[model samples]
Target: MALYKHSAYVKTSTSDEFDKVYSPGASTPHSGIYRCEGCANEIAANQGNPLPPQNHHQHTSAQGSIRWRMIVYAQ
Candidate 1:
């Protein structure tokens, strides 16, 4: 499993001129929690932290253990 912290995530307000929105990242995060983009729930995480998903899942990047950090928008 990989590792990351809360700081790995970044937030934004709006999307592009069309429908596609993008956030650029040159490097991957150290370690943190990852949530499902579908259900918006913790699907995987590393270490015995307070984060949910009690156990690790097959979900994650193959490049390395990075935060799949979920984005939450305020309505």
Candidate 2:
């Protein structure tokens, strides 16, 4: 099974632009948006921890891991 994760910064966005862009599915939580440091994209609202897909390569550091995931916007 594929582990799916949402962005955190998107959940923190004060503006509704993220919500307008992503238009997360009904199953998606209606939270704030998290800013993705990796892609410079706005995380969708109400999603989980907006991390990259498990199969993708993520950025790792000695201290811990950075949330470097791709932003999926509603088209």
Candidate 3:
């Protein structure tokens, strides 16, 4: 993992669609595991129906760039 020390606020628009998600116990689990095609997130279906609750970002990676839009050079 790359270590970044800077953060910025983003005022942007995105068209990528996010798949529907459910809380740990919100979905009907099965005898097998289920994975998300979009982000590769997984649902432990073996944990029993409506698998144990989990955090949304638990199985995902955080993506963003920390770049300087305005770097003051010699004026």
User: Considering every candidate listed, which one attains the maximal lDDT?
Assistant: 2
Worst 10 residues of 2 by lDDT: 21-30
lDDT of model 3, residue 64: 23
Candidate 2 Cα RMSD (Å): 11.9
Flag the better candidate by lDDT, 2 or 3: 2
lDDT of each: 0.34, 0.36, 0.34
Tens-place lDDT digits, model 3, residues 1-75? 112255343222332212333344544423434444334444444323454444344443443211111111111
What TM-score does model 2 achieve against the real structure?
Answer: 0.25
- lDDT of model 3, residue 45: 49
lDDT of 1 by residue, 1-75 (tens): 233467445444464322322222312222333444323344333333333331333434543332235333222
- Full candidate order by lDDT, most accurate first: 2, 1, 3
Q: What's the CA RMSD of model 3 in angstroms?
A: 17.5
Which candidate has the top score in TM-score?
A: 3
Q: How far is each candidate from the true structure, as Cα RMSD in Å?
A: 12.1, 11.9, 17.5
Q: List runs of model 1 lying over 4 Å from the truth.
A: 1-29, 47-75
What's each prediction's clash count? 5, 17, 2
